[model samples]
Every structure is written in structure tokens, then in C-alpha cells.
Target chain A: MADTVLEVRDLSLEYRSRRGPVKALRNVSFDLYKGETLALIGESGCGKSTMGFALIRLTPGTAKITNGNVTFVDGPNRINLMEMSENEIRRFRWTDMAMMLQAALNAYNPLIRIQDHFIDTAKAHGLNNKSEIIARARRLLTGVQLDADRVLPAYPHELSGGMRQRVLLALGLLMQPKIIILDEPTTALDILTQRSIIELLRKLKDEFNFTMIFISHDLSLAAELADRVATMYAGQIVELTDVFSAFEKPRHPYTFGLTRAVPTLHGAVEKLESIPGSPPDLVFMPSGCKFHPRCPFATDKCKEVEPKLTAYGGHQVACHNWQQVLEESQKAR
Target chain B: MALLELKHITKQFRQGKKVVTAVDDVNLAIQDKEIICLVGESGCGKTTTGKMAAGLLDQTSGQILFEGKDISKLSGPEFMAYRRSVQMVHQDPFSSLNPVRTIYQTISAPLLYHKFAKDERDARRRSIEILEMVDLTPAEEILDKFPHQLSGGQRQRVSVARALTVNPKFIVADEAVSMVDVSIRASLLNMLRRLNQELGVSFLFITHDLALAKYFAWEGRVGVMYTGRMVELSRSPSLIEKPLHPYTAALMSAIPEADPRLTRSKERIVLRSDDIPSLTKLPPGCHFHPRCPVWLEGKCDKVQPILTEMGPGHQVACHVAFDITGGGSKISAGTR
Candidate 1:
């Protein structure tokens, strides 16, 4: 088997607020195989985005990595990202793994032209030949179906939201990184623009053979893009499986609630069954399982005992009554 | 009587010496207890039309009729009454509700203003009742809590309850669920559907998300707008099943399917590299001609097409629709 492109083990992140340290993520573990797209899907405050930011060591000032390790496999060499020095991490950022942030319009410098941004990055890495760097940037733009001449001279503000996102995706691929982290890349664009951007990402992934960590609040989009899916609740990953299995046969109650909550074209016009309550407050999370407050299948044991993620049918789920829930979900289907 | 009618409405704002036509010669009829989804991309005049329907802005020409009465000339008290009957739920739940006010005050203030409730006690009771109607349990606790203490879903519920408190017949929900998480969006949509089924409230649901609109609207008519013109209006399922306009086809193709197994096969309709033409200086004819993928040789650029009935209840405004309909004759925009 090919080596894993990225491996995250026992990763926990905490945000130090005025009240106390809020455990944003707990024991989150996953692996992205080479050239595979892994989607981290969940509602807001589920720590999906937090996990993405943590992987890149770009957590906010309030957040701190409490425990865990992230290992990046570079060809035959294994690099421990968490232990890397600051300068080394900077050097590895674009060349090894790049990130396309959620807000593309804000990512670029407003005062500079698009081409200048690429020129600066290429020059910083000591690629001083201007014509060669320009050619590379143009090629990247063409790969994303953007007009090189028009986009290279326009300032970030001059471009539309869709065009700006395409430019950012082009920039992320410029270094020819092994993995690209897309954090809700199409969230800001309209439907038409979003479709184009997703198509571009799919095409680029096929051409460059890069692994992807796709994070989003929309499960349907994630289903369309990712090979495997992981569903997060509160601070932990409650379910992880292949995309088809995760959607067709979700084992966890939280996953079931989330999937049913999305309005689909194929589904009947039934009253959407929403989870009764909201997510637990991170500062004062419920005892035992953090999801017990909202889980309809919660029992006395669920309120008192935490469930570990256990393997079942080539998937991992963290629920005491996952089997019963799966059976019930199948009956409903 | 039609609940509301906008006939030949047009709006222009003067920026320096130039006039920006935001809404141009638009006509629409909204039926009672019906949900009309006005969908388009950003800056497509959907929100502006919604604002006009809610009496937030005045049309530069033509008339706005409410229940067969010309409300275009109504002012002061009459306009206030019109406004009370048509409440608006804004897009951003985070900033829409005041930070300091409790949910009770946010919802009850409208009740108090309209004198719908007898006193504070009655208003508070009604506030809690409205919260329950939106499926928000433990209404008393939520009533006393401020907006910041609630999540996006909770805040939106508060907004809906506030809109419902006035007993408005028509509600303009402009991208109401766009800001919330997807998990909560369905619940909110269900709540809206319930309200429509039970209260017989007419809705002008404006959103860029087409899937949500399809779920909530029955007999829903979709309006595809480009620039300041309505390109097409047709039944929901018919439009999605077989889109007539190129723009509609593109929009339908944009929706990401729920099943990952089915790959999207439609070729993406790539628009021109030029920016959306300025409203102040619209291209001479067919504002969409510059970006349209299948622009005809000279008809699309030289002459504009007026909205013509292609079939029963299906209207399209494009020169090519006739050619597709097996007619060679072209309709001029000026004739309309």
C-alpha cells in the first residue's frame, strides 16, 4: 500500500478563553492516504475547522495544541510537523503542503496585482528567473481555466468572488504540494460559481495527484468531493467511513440527525427531523458523552459513561448503541 | 384578489451624474398564501425587488397594488399599516437582533407597538406562545436570554417569532437561513413550512440557494434574474427537470447532488471574463449578451427580447427561446 500522506493521532486542541481552557477537540485521529480526498463534515462548533487549522499549525492566539502529532510523509522521508522549527515549518508550508482558506478575497493583498503576489512567493523561495516563474503561474492559471492575462494584472478587489477563489486555488497549487487543505472553499460563491470551483478542484486533483483535506459544514458538497468522510460532534470524531457508507448507513445518532437535516432533491417532502437540542457549550460540556444532551438514543449509561470509537464493518463509530441505531436507520430507509 | 402586484416597476439611483437602474420595467403578481421564490445570483435585483415589495423603497415608475388597491401613492399612516402587514426577516441573524435585548423584548416590542396584546403580561405570554409555535421548547428560559446567549439557529427562531408576532399576512424572508449551519437549516425550513401550512402566510422567499426553496415552496415559481431583468419564470420541478434558458440550465447544473456516487456530467457554462456590467451603463441590448454562452449571430446583441409565454404559466425573455420553439421571427424589446 502507498504511504499515508498525512497522519493525525490523538490530536486535542484547547482554546484558552477568559473563563478557562475550552477543549475544542479531543482525541481526534485520522489519516489521509496519498491522492485521496478526506472530508471532515459537521455543524458549527464541531471542531472540524479547528482540526484543519491545527493541522497547518495556524490555530488562533487563543487556541493551543494540548496533545497529538501530525506526520507528513514526503516521498521516502517521514517529517514530524509538530516538532519542526519555525523556519523549517515556513519553508515546508507552500512547497510541501498548501492551504486554500475559506475567505479567498481577504487572503490576498489588496494593493498588489495578482501576478506580483506569485512573483513574490517564487522569489522568496529563490526562484529568481522572472520569465520562468511567470510561465509557471500562467500554467497554473490555465489549469484552473482562468484567463492568465486578465487575472495576472487585476488587483484582488477587481475580480469577482468566484474569480478570486480560482486565483487562490491556482496559488495553492503553484508550489506543486503533495496535499492541499480546502476550508469551505466554495462557501462564499454563488451556486454557478461554486459548481465551477468544485469542477476545477476535481480536475486539479486528478492532474496533480494531490491528497485533499476538505472541510465544510455542508455534507452534500462533502459527499460529492471526498472519498472518505468523518463526522465530528462537540470535540470528537463520532463516525468515520467511506462517503457512500457514511451517507447511506450512518451509525451514530449525531451523524443520522445531520444527514436527515439537509434538504435533498431525492427525498420526500417530510417534516425534517431536527435534533431536539443544540450542541453542548464547550466551556461546560455535559458529563459522560458530550453529545448525550442532544442524542435521542441516550440512556442512563450514555449519560454516565463515555463511548470509545470502536471498529464495525470497516468503519469506526463512537456510540454505545451504534448497532441498534444502524438497524433502526436501515428500517427507516 | 392578488395579495400584491408590481406593475412595470422601475428604480434608479443617481450616482454622481449617472443613473443606476436597479429594477427595470418589472411586473409580478404574488398570490395569497403562496410562497414565491425569487432566485438569482448576487446583484441580480432579487433583494431590491423584495425590499420594494416590503415598502422599504419607492419605485421610480409604475404602480404597486396591494389587494386591488394602488398602494404606490399611500403615505404616512397608510404606508405604516402596509409595513405592519408585511414583515421582513433579514439574512444575518447575528446582527439583525439587538445584542442587549432579551428574546421577550425583541418579539414583544412589535406586539406592544401594534397593540396586539393588552399589556406587558399579555405580550410576554404571546411571546412565549410564538416561540413554541416555532418549535422552540422551554420558551420561558429563551425569552429572558439575550441574543448572544443563543446560537445561530436560536437567534433565527427569535427572528421568526418576532415576525410572526405582528400577525403579518406576508413575510419577506431574504436569505433567512443562509447564514446558519446546514444541520439547523432544515429545521428552520420545516418551521417555515409549518407556519405557511397553518397560518396561511404568503412568503416572498429570496435566496441564492435553490435546494432550500424547492423544499419549502409548493406550486413554487422560480424567477431567474440577470442584471436587472427577469430572464425566466416557471414551475419549480419543470424548471429543474428540463431548463429552457441557458442560465437556468447552468444554475440547475450547479446544485451538488446528495449522492457522491453520481458524477456531474453537465458541461459548466463559463461566463465571460469581464465583470458584471455596471447597472449605470448597461450594454445596449440584451444585458446578458456579453456573458451568454450561446449568443446568436446578431439578434442577441442588436435587439432585446420581451418576456413571452412559451407554454402555460411558463414565461421566458430571450430571443433564442423562439428559435428553440421553431419560430424564425424575432420579438423586439421596444415593442413591450
Candidate 2:
């Protein structure tokens, strides 16, 4: 069996706004194996990005990890990121883990040259040689299929959206980190550029053998790139399984609903059956199960008692009536 | 009959000392009740073309003919009638709708402006009907609620309802579902599809995603653009199955298959050094020859290819594409 690179146990996070306390993530637990791609997928505001932030201990403004242990496994040493000092975390970041955000097009400093972004990153990580940094930047830029000379001196606005995204990718690889957190890295890009970026990312992961955490609101996209998939709803992981199983034999009602809702590129055109209601507001979350309000198979029991994610035949699902949901869907079919 | 036809239309904009041709010479025709999807990247002028076709913007040169009559000089009742015949659905549901305006007011504004209703009560009743048409049910509940209170999907439905309130024969949906979430996107797309089927409304659906364009307009035609020029036009299946232009092939190759196994085993064309050409300084000859994978040495660099028909209702603009597929000797661009 492959070793676990990172383990998030009973992870709970919340943000205190003027409105109230909003639970961004609730008891989220998962294991990221070495050299594996883990996809966290859900609707917008489903806390997938929140989980990414919490894992790296960079939960944004006013957000606090109320409960949980995010342990980063390094060889034999287990580092609990939550307990690490600010200085320690800062040192650990980029060198140990790097993040390519959703709006990566705007990630670069618009006024500065692309080479300056690379050099600044390298110098921060203690690479003092200017020639070495320039050479390294050239190599990385070439790896992402960009002309090093043409792009290095150009400002962010000078490069195309695809080229700018490539610069961000090269920046993410500056330190050769063990883990890469890609939060919708290709969301705004065109399909051609998006495909090439994904291909390049997958190729880089294979070449470097680094773990990847892909956070997207697209399930089909998640299925295309990830080995394992975690379906998040509201703030909890409703289902977690391998990509094949998650797509082929989803146990949770939300997963089933999602599989039917997305339009497909291949196979017959299936009418998209949208889940009736919208995702619940985080501030005024539903009583028991957060997804209960929108779930078609929701019952009185589901409305009162929250279901914990439990393992069944190597897959984890948080649903009170998976069996009934299956039977009812089967009967309807 | 063709409801609208764009004959050799061109749009240019001035930027400092540079004059950028946002849309080059193009031709397209939208038949009554037919959905024609315009697929391209950001700078490819798909949105601008849609805006021109909707009468929201005017073309700099050439002619825009609606029902075989020029629309450029439309005045008085003709311009007012044209406005009612065409409508637009913008991309962002968040900013498109007025946050302070209730669904009723937002939908009824156009009807009230054009005097489509007898009075306020009559206007609201028709707005409710349009709301129900786009699947916003219990219309009374949504009618009074402000835009902020509704979900993204609901807001998009409201926008569609507003467009429908004018009883427009055509709609220019500019990236309409791109801002909405994936699960909600389908419902909106289906609603658009339903409108096309049931209401017989022509659509100039503009978007960057070809898969979505194909999904919504399966039976209709798709036009592929590159650097403000329509490179290929064909029925949806043919375009997806046997795309002729190199750019179309690149775009098609970029689509992520839903199946992981298929994607893993699939061979994708990752272009080498794709620097999107500037609108003001497009390269000589083919606009895409710079990044094309199978570009001809001297021919593709010097000769600008025109949109040439290769099969029934299918057209492509590339010199060596046919030769690569051994279709070079079979047929010429003019034979169709």
C-alpha cells in the first residue's frame, strides 16, 4: 500500500462574520496518498476551497479552525500544521506545499516582469545565485511550453491568459514542493488552454511524484483528473471513493443527483435533472443534515439525526438511507 | 425563411494609434426558430458578433439584414419593432439583474417601456406568465422578492423571463450559463433548449465552451472562430467528429472526456508555444498558423485561407488540413 502523505482528521473550521458564526468545514477527514491526485468537488460555497485552506493552515480572514488535526507526514516525522508557529508555517509553505488559486490569471504581479516573480520566489527559498535562478526559470517556463526569452521580460498584461496561467504553474514549481494545491487553476481559461494545463500538471506530478489536491466545482472535471474523489456538500464530505466508483456507483443521494445534473461530452445526451433547491446558506444551516433541504430522498429521520461518514466496502458515505435511495432510484428506472 | 442574415459584416474599434478589427469579414444566417452556436476563445469576436446580430451594437461595414431588409437605417416604428424582435441574455446573473429591483419590476420594465401591457396589473400578469415559461414557479413568491434574495439559477431564470417578456423572436445569449454553477447550468441550458423547441425562437448562443454549445444545440450548427474570423462552420456532430480547421481540432482535442479511463488513454494535442495574437497586430496569412501543430512550411504562412465548404453545410479555412487527412484530391472548396 502507498504511504499517506497527509492526513486530515476530524477537521472543523468556521468564520465569524457580522452576520454570525458560519461553519465552513465540518469534521472533514481524508488521507492524501503519496503521488496520488485527490479531487474535492462540490457546488459553489460547498467548502471544498475551505478544506484546501485549512489543510495548509491558511484559512482566510476571520476564519478559525475550531476543531481538527491536520497532520503533514514527512518521512517518519508527523507535523501538525495547526500547532506550527507562524514562522515555521511560512518556512514550510512553498518549499513543502504550494497553492495555485482559482483566479490564477490575476495571481501574478501585473506591473513586475515575469522573471522578477520567479526570482523573488527563489530568493525567498534561499536560492542566492541570480544566474542559477534565471536558468531555473527558463527551464520551468520551457517545461510549461512557453518561450523563456519572450515571456521572462514581459509584464503580466503582455502575456495571454494561457501564458499567464503557465507563469503561475512555473511559480508553483519554483520550490519543487512535495504537495501542490490546485484550486480551480484552469477555471476561467479556454478549453484548449485548460486541457493543456491539466495535461501539463498531470505530467509534472508523474515526473516529480508529488501529491496533488485538486479542488473544483466540476465533478466531471474532477473525474477526468483525480484518482479518488470526495463529494462535499454544505460543509461536510457526503461521499468519498475512487473516481471510478464515485462516477459508476455513487452511494450518497447528493452524488447521484450530481452525476445526473452535469452535461456530458460523451455517451447519450441525458436530460439534466437539477436538484430542486439550492445549497443552504452557511450562516443559517439546516437543522440536522445540511443537504437535507435539497435532497429528494430526505426523510424525517434525515431531518433530525445527522449521519456520520462511515466506511462501506472501501468507500465512505454520510447518508442515513443509502440503501433506500438506491432502491427507490432503481425502482424509478 | 432566414430571420436574420449577416452579410460580410465587420466591426472595428480605435485604440490609441492602433485600429483593432474586433470582428473581420464574416457571414452567418439564423433561420427562424434555429439555434446557431458561435464557439471561440475570448479574443475571437464571438460576443461582438452576437451583440451586432442582436442590434445592441452596429457593424462598421457590410450589411445586417433582418427578413432580407437592411437594419442599419431602421428608424421610427422600424427601430422600435426591431428592438422588440431581438433581445439579449448576459453572462453574469449577479450583476445583470438590478439588486434592488424585484422580479416583477425587472421583468415588467421592457413590457412597460414598449407598451406591451395595458397597465401595471396587466404587465405583472404577463411577467408572471414569462416567469412560469422559464420554470420559475409559484410565480407570486418570486415576483415580489428582490434579486438578492434569489439563487443564481433563479436569477438567470428571471433574466430569461425578462428576455421572453418582450416576446422576442431571437435572443443573443452571451455566455449565459458560464457564471452559474455546474448543477444549475444544465437546468438553464435545458430551459434554453426548451425555448428553442417549444417557442421556435432563434438564438445566437455565444460561449467559449464547445461542449456546452454542442449539448444545447445538438441539432443546430456550430461556427468556430479564430482571431475574429470564422474558421469553420458545420452541423454539431460533424464539427465535433471531423473538425477540418486546425484550431477546431485543437479546441476539440482540449475537451476533457467525462470518463477518466478514456481521458487517460487518450492522446491529446498539446500545442507548442501558443501565444494568442493581438487583435491589432494579427500575423500575415492565417491567424492561427503561429501555433498550429501541422502548419505548412511556406504555404500556410503566406496564403490566407478562406472559409471553404468541404461537405454539406460544412466549411473550413485551412490549406493543408485536407491533405493531411487524404481529402485533398477528393473535393475542392467550391464544389458543394
Candidate 3:
């Protein structure tokens, strides 16, 4: 509904393995709207993190983007990231977009003070005035509810896990980028710490109005943060819809199964039904639908024909038997 | 009689010059086929308590009784028997399984050592039976594969199978399913529940996830720990619904539910501080007092509170909770 800030068209990537190419992403297409949080939710090895890395063109050496066009649009200027030179992309990275990686402890150098990380990032983005950089970093540290005085001078190991995560968040916002991608930011933190971080993110989003792509396996975080959710399974976008529709009326069976698998903290304890099988191997994938091996409503057609992501009403789902899935999900409620 | 019991369990570790009390004055008794989940944040001593229960680590001051005999005082054969009856399933399936050993070699070693199987042929048969019991299908195919060949869930099942090799009466599963995928977690928990039901093996399950604790130990009991103390212990469903301790209530209110509407609308208990204090420099009196929302100034900071019975089968350790719950009728008598 809002302005489209980034468009990914037919994006596909693969990892060069000893056996063969591991198809990590397959024909994934999506539009990221300005000032909206789009959550990429999936289990492990579902290419959610790969999608993040691919967006910034910072994928590992073994990863090769085979086919894709990533266009970044701001006002009248349209720039295809795939066409950018290595030097140009480096200059465009922190100023236009930034990615906060997982495990903040590992993100920072153990020997350096927190201020150095901020200063180095700012300098790389061509901001050489040391005092100005320190002032901005202090402001962000305080904005994240950390004591700027104590945190700015301490090493990464000296700070707690939650504090380190907050520092990383502050550093991501140091250049004041319009788009930020966070990968499993709160995975290992305590519940109270997670709540505080969620609250802080909400506050930051309201104040800054920056577009965010949150990558996490935790469904509750996605439910609390995202405007729209894309369920990734076996290196493909299986379902894409509004957060409400994604949870209340998930059309794809894998999305439905994921919503049912997690137990809620406050609710009637119902018998949870887990997805029947494990995720498919990326190198030697099964034919037809990637999720067909675990789908209860899978038919003979599903085994032979690959279903494309088709729009029905307002949402998109890649499933042949979605009507039956909708009916059964409604009945379960 | 209880199958296993830990009385006044206290574990202290010497780190450089300072002595860190990892677990302090904890008491628990698990009966036959009972499931008691210990839920807490990291550095809260849940794992240390579990290791003590499994006899993997010795408690500095405590009594671990297996079949009414103290484990520390047991003779060589008696200690071996105690070790056989109690097993541990660690958190990381990747590192817990020996990388070099094949699945058959790892599982059969315990069977042959404890003489659960008569010979090598018998050991192979028993290993397959145990692997099949944990639902690792095509057991014959899996036996020859090394740990790296299996998925995380498969490796965890192998771990469970290895724990089951000795036919343990009590298994201490410390965050057993945390490392697996969300879809796989439920099935693994279901398999563990099935083991509890069919084999009559009790468990001391440990995890930081309250939702998972509620799901796994719904029919059993849940214990809430903070720092190195047991703050609350009660039946699972009630403990989740009507938590008495402030820490437990804070954790319950703070956790985000999977539902969109429920998670957003739920009220939260904001703590005084977010940082969990270090073990070496723990605050005096109650370990949670510094961050407690309902802390008493003079009493809570001056005196530690022991577990007191608030209602039927419910135990809480807090001065404010004790006051709010009518000051209790009796102190917990060290038996669940």
C-alpha cells in the first residue's frame, strides 16, 4: 500500500558444494515497502539469512547469486544493486542500508572499546570528525536505554548479552540508514531482555520510521514486530500476507503447521501437531512442492506438479490444495 | 519412596581467587515416572543442579540419595549402580555425541559396559531396539553413520537412545530440545513424554523457555529458579496460570506468546533492572531482590527466604509472596 523502496525479482542463489550446487534460494520475489517491517520467518537453513546477505551483496565467497535483479528506489532515483561496482557498493552500504548480524559478541572485536566500533564504521562511511561521531554514538546508546557513559568505553565481553545486542542496534543506526536488517537479534537473550528490546524497537520505529527486514525463527517476535510476514521453506517463499492474515488464516500448509507447532504462554493447552518430516536437503531436493513430504493435504498432483505463488484475494500462497487447507484451518479454530 | 532426591544441595566452584556458589540450598524429590522441569535464565544454576542430580558433578554440601542411600557415601559397585540408574542428556547434540564414533559404537558401548547386552551381536540388536524406540526410523541405516551425517533432530534422538541404553530410572534432560527446529521440537517432546509414560522413567527437565516447560511438563511439575535458588515449585498448569512468586510472574508476563493479539495485549511486569547480577558478586540476602518489582526494602535485602507452602503442592520463596499469601501454614519439608 505504501511506496515500494526495494524490489527483488526472480532472485536465485546457490552455494558451490563438493557434491553439487546447493540451491539456497529459488525464484524469490518480493517488494519491501518504505517504513514497514517485513519479517522473514522460517526454521534453520531455510535461506532467510541468505536472503539478508544477498540483499546487501555481502554473501559468503562460496555463495553465488545466479539470477536476480535487486532495485533500490528512492524518490525518482532508481539504482539496480546488481549493477553496482564493488567500490560503489562499499560506499553505498552503511549510508543507505546496514545489516546488524547475529551474535553481537562475535560482531565486535574483543579488544576494542565500543566507541572504536562506532568511530570506525562512521569513518568508513566518510565521516572523519571524531567528536561528532562520538556524540552521535552516545545519543544512540542512550536512546537504546543503555548508560552511554558505562557502555561506550567497555569491551564487548564486559557487557552482558542484552547490552551487547543493544550496542549492535545502536551501531546499526549510527549512520542513520533508511533500511536495517537484523538477523536473529534476540535469539539467546533472556525473556525480560527480549521484552525490553522489543519495546525499544517499537519506540525506534515510531521515531525513525525506517524500513526493517527482521529475520528470525521465533514466531512470537515476528508476530509482535512485523507488518507483513513471508514464510520461507526450503529456499522459497511459500506464503506472503499481512501479519493478521498470516497468523489467523494461513493459506499455505507449512505456514499453518508452523503456527500450530509453537505453544503459547497464555492459552488453553491444546494438542499441538508438528510437521511430520524434516526439511529437505538443499542439494538434492525432492520434486514438486518442497513441503509436500510433510503436508497432510498433499495429493498426487502435488507430488508431480510444482505450484507457483498465486494470489488469492489479498495474500499470496504457493500451494495446490490451499482451499482445503483454509477450510480445515477454519474448522480447527 | 522417591526414586531420587537432592537434599540441601549447594555447589561452589573456585574461579581464580573467588568462590562462586553455583547452586545454593536447593531441595527436590522426584518420584517414580514424575517429570519436574527446572526453568530459569542462564547462570541461574539450572544446569548445575541437573549435573548434581545426575552425579556428573559433586555438590560441595548436599546429599544426593538414590533409593534412600547417599551417593557420596556409596561404595564402588554401589556408585556404579547409581550412575547406571541415572543418565544425562545434554543440551548440544552436536558436541554431546562423539564426532568420531559411529551411532552403533556410541550406543552399544553403554549396553556392553553395563551388560544390558550379553555380546557384540546382542549389543547391536539392543542398540537398534533403543534407536527404534526413540523413533529414529531405519535404525539399521543410521547405525553405521557418524554424528556429522545426521541432522540435529536425528542426533538428539541418538542422544536419547544413548541415555536409554542403560535403562536409566531417572534422566536429567538439560535443554534437550532447544537446539532443534521448532517443528521438530514438538515431536521430540512427544517422544520424551512417550518414554515417560511407557518406560516409567522420571525426568528433571531444564530449560529457559516457559512455554516449552508448560508444554512438556503439563501433567507433571514446574520449578522456577533465579540466581541459585528455587523461587517457586508447583504443578505445571497452575504454576503457569497462577504464579505466586514475583520472579515467576515477571517471567510469565514478560514472555511473548505466539499469537499476535495475545502477545501485544498482554500486560507486563517491568523489573527494576534488566541486568542479571554476576554469580561471583551476587547481592546479599535474596538473589533477586535487586531486580525484583515487589521488593521489600529492609527485609528482602537483609534476610533470605526459603521455600514455603502457599497452597496445595505449591512452594514459593519470597518475603512479599509469603506476606501476600497469608504468611504460609508450613515451611516445605524437603519432599515433593
Candidate 4:
């Protein structure tokens, strides 16, 4: 809650489709504090990944940012990322803000050795010294608990999925960016491997103190790593609160449903109720609230008029029936 | 009597020259209307075991007995009967359902082939009934829709309905609900649970998730797999509460639950190594010994341990778990 590193305001994006423009992001607004991890949790097609791409201006050609701005702050310098020219933004990226895309194992060139990747990244960022790049890469790879000697000369395909993910993580931190956006970092990993990655991430965060935007659908990842949590549904931030508040006292019905839907590894066995229906179609979204059709507490107002995010107690929630949801959650407890 | 029994089943695949032992002498006996979940990481042979159990894949050795009859020895109608009685619902609903076929066609094919339906008219009626069984409302409308038109959850439900068309006595669902969204996963699981109870169909639910395995098999049993071997088997609650095998304990400890305070505060059982041993060149003795925290170096790395009964309905394949010597003390000291 101190020193805002990144401020995203009214960010909207749409993808060109034959049916129409698919509104992927709608009025997404959040502030990422320095040295804190903000997890953006959502199901597929909820624009969580899109928001990560939009933050670094790395979305596909079909996607167009319709409105809004991202302000990157570093000490006395404050720059609007959206207003920067293509070359300026290109230079600004990786050096100031880095993004580790989902399934980054495939992002590497299969022909090149791991060392070449570090060299290429360093050269792109204007760090030309070969010895310096190798030294930095060695430090990062060792820090991630990998043997740099074995990993450096091997191709991406030679490494296992977990090792490849760690290589990517090490590569992402090479430039020492102030902000790191990791998209589904531990997805597709085994339970033990995921735990190791989570532990490594926590250790790295503590050591580096870099602001992080962790995007994942797995609630466990958020519970373990996030300082703050954002629940995204239908291209909108439905809820934003501290990690403890979001899990223990969720204001939004979607968040509550998500928490209840997942069967925890421990604790008393309880009946879990899945939310009815699927995610809304992006091109032809439902009227009013996008989640109303599936919400158990939906009413006429919810079906007709969408609710804006309103501060309640200590967190922000975009729901017409937060009080009722709170009451229901408390009653269950 | 056991509905389906897999006795010392071993499946091997030839990757060019080297033989990959996918499933290594895994033994299991599934009771009538029982739910047994096989859980492990990728390439741990859970899927291969499921495929063998479903009668789709032939094991290199060992016997699969359906109703106490050797499935491999069955001929003509007997083989056909075994095939029809055991069905498989795959992990991906998108690819599993034929894109060209409508829900009605997919459902009716199995019914007509198996002679479960009297005529086309009867097949249509039965199709609707089966669709409704999976909670797909207005079965009439859903029957006309193609796989691409339905959501992931809906397509999965349609796949289940198709599997149910044959009236299978046993079902092998391999990561059945993993592809669907988290919010709809419980509904799919609940539907499966209901079918198991109401239809009296036994299930071999295979998944990588320990939590899902525990939830779905709470009343039945859970088996833990590592490198093509069954390392541990027990009732769900006891298995979760007190995992016997070091691998199972590591898996149980590694899982981060969907709770803030609990997950953060929970102690992790760190493995000695993170890499899973390759099936082609597996370690000499216990495949898990390389990564196991409580592994006895001289004993575990030399002689492979078989499933040894620890208690009532509980079995673990680890020398340290039984502790012929002082291995239990090392387990307590190494993990925390």
C-alpha cells in the first residue's frame, strides 16, 4: 500500500472478429504497489492474460486498445506507457517492466542453447558485455536452484517442463525490472514442482522486492503467493482486496463461488456447489451484469443494470448483492 | 465379488528400440459400485492403467478380470460384452467428441451398436433419457447441437451421456473434469458421483490432483502412483491424513490448498531431487528413492519394495514406511 509502481485506469481492449469486436478488457483499473504481489485470478477468456499483455503493449495485431492509460512510476519519473512511441515502448519494456507469458517453455527457440537466450536478451537490452551477461545469468540460474553449467549449453527441449519454466523465470529477471508480470507460472507443473516454484518465487520476491502481477486461474497459487487478489469475470475486475479478505470474506459472489468450488487438500469434507452455466460469450455478452445469468442471488436489478465497483468495509467489489452474499457466507460459517 | 480386477498388470511400449515400462506390475481389485482414484504426475502411468482397465490398451503381462473372468481369454460375444460393459471418458472433451457428430448421433451409435435400443425411435427416446440423466436440460434441443456449439462443460456432459448409452457396469474417467472451468468442475463431479450411486456403475477415476482424488473417492479408496508403480493404497481419509509412502506424503505436503492461512503456514516436505526419473532408464530399485526424503540409500536404491500391508485396507511400497530399522526417525527429521 505504499509507492504505486503501476497504475492501470479504465483500460479497455477489443479483438477484431467476424461476429463483431470481442471486448476482451473493459474498464480494468488497479494499482500495483511496489514490493507486493497482486494476483489476477479468473477463468479462461476472462481477460486476465489479455490485461498482462496490454500492460506491456505486447498483444496480438487483432487486439486494439480502445481507451485508458497505464502509468509507470519510478521515483520522480512518471511515464504514460500508452502514449510512448513504438520504439520508445520497445526500449522501455524488459528494461523497466518484464512479462513472463503463459507456457513460456515454447517461447524459446528450440535451436539455440540456454546461454544464447540470455545473451540475446542482454544484447537486446543494450547490455553488450558477454562475460557480464554470463555472470548475471549464472547468478539468476543458481538463485533459482538450477545448475547453470548444465542448463546453459542445453537446448530448451532438452530441459524438463519445470526446468524450462525456471529458465524462463531466470531469463525474465536478467534485466532486473522493477515490475514482473507472470502468467500462470506454475500451471502444467506437478504438485511437488509447483510447490518448489512457489517457494522459489517467494524467496526471490523477498530478496529482490520487485512488484509482481501474478495471473492464474488456480486459487491455490493466489492463496500461497498473492498479497492482494483481483477476481476477473467477463473482462471486468469483479473484486479487488487483500488476500486474507478476498478468501475469508469475499464480497463478490463469483469469488465466493470460486472459493467454495475448489476442494481443499485439507480440512473437513464439505459439499461443494459449482456455479451453474459457463462463461459468457465475449462478442455477444449478456445485458447488465455478465454473471447474473449464473448467479444464485441474481435479481431483476442485476439482470437490467450492471453494478460498479463500490468500496465496502475494506475492499472493492462490483456486485449488487454484496451484503446478501456476506450474510450468506457468514451464515454458512 | 470384485467387478473388475487388475492382477500384476504391466504395460510396455517400444519407443524405437528401448522398451518403456509404462505400468509395472500394478495390482488392483475394484469392488462393485466402488470408486477408486489413481493419482500421480504426468507419465506416471495412471492414464495407461486406465486405458488397460477400459480394455482399450493391451498390457504386456498380467490379467484383467471382468466379473472374475480373464478378459484376455474371452472370445466372440464374451470379449464384446467386456468391451461394451467398460467405457472410457477421456480428459479432453473437445477432441473426445467427434466434431461432425451431433449429440443425438453420438449417443445413439453406442446404443444401436450394442443393441441397447429396439429401433431408431427407441434410440431417440433413450438418447433423450440419457441426456437428461447428465442434467442437460431440454434434451431434445441439446440432441441437435454439435460438439463445437456446446460449452466445455456441456460437451463433457454429452461425452458422459454417450458413455452411459451402453449402460457400462464400469467407467474409467481419466482427468474427466480437469478441462472444465473451476466453477463448473464441481457440477460435473457431482453428476459423476450421482451416476455412480444411482446407476450402480463402478468408477476408476484417474487424476493428477490429490484434492480431487480425495474428494471423489472419500467413501471408496485412493491409490498413489510413481514411475509406473503403485506406491500406496488406502481409504481416502486415512491416506490423506497419514500418508505412508514418502512419495504420497511429499505429494500431500506439496499441495497448496485453497486457503490463505493454511497454505502459507503448512509445512512442505521437500524432495531430495525435483526431477522425475525417466521410465526408460528407471533407477535400479525404487524409482522414487532418488527424490524421496525418507529413502534408505543402501536398501531402497538396491532392492525394489513391493506393496506391504500396513494396516486394515492400507498398503505402502516402501521399506522405510514399515521401518525394519530406524527409518521412521529419519522420516520425521528429514521432512520438517
Write down the lDDT of every candidate, Cα atoms only: 0.82, 0.84, 0.91, 0.91
Tens digits of per-residue lDDT for model 1, A139-196: 9999888899999999999888988998998888878888899899899887777877
Better of 1 and 3 by lDDT: 3
Of 3 and 4, which scores higher on TM-score?
Answer: 4
Per model, the share of native interface contacts recovered reads 0.69, 0.64, 0.75, 0.81
Q: Across residues B38-109, which tens digit of lDDT does each residue of candidate 2 receive?
A: 999888999999999998888999899888778977777987888889999999999999988888888888
Cα lDDT for residue A9, candidate 3: 93
Could you tell me how far off, in angstroms, the CA of residue A157 lies in candidate 1 after the best superposition? 1.0
In model 3, state the lDDT of residue B37.
Answer: 97
Poorly placed runs, candidate 2 (over 4 Å): A324-333, B270-273, B321-336
lDDT of 1 at A216: 90
What RMSD does model 3 have? Answer: 3.3
Residue-by-residue lDDT tens digits, candidate 2, A240-306: 9999878777788888887777665555556778787788889998888788888877899989999
Enumerate the candidates' DockQ scores in order: 0.60, 0.66, 0.82, 0.87
lDDT of 2 at B332: 23
Summarize candidate 4's per-residue lDDT along A1-333 as a digit string, tens digits. 599999999999999999999999999888888899999999999999999999999999999999999999999999999999999988888889999978967779999999999999999889999999999999999999999999999999899989988999899899998999999999989888898899899899888878899999999899989999999999999999999989988879999999999998888888889988889999999999999999999999999999998787659999999989978877765
Worst 10 residues of 4 chain A by lDDT: A324-333
Residue pairs in clash, model 4: none
TM-score, cand. 2 vs. native: 0.94
Q: Candidate 1's chain A scores what TM-score?
A: 0.97
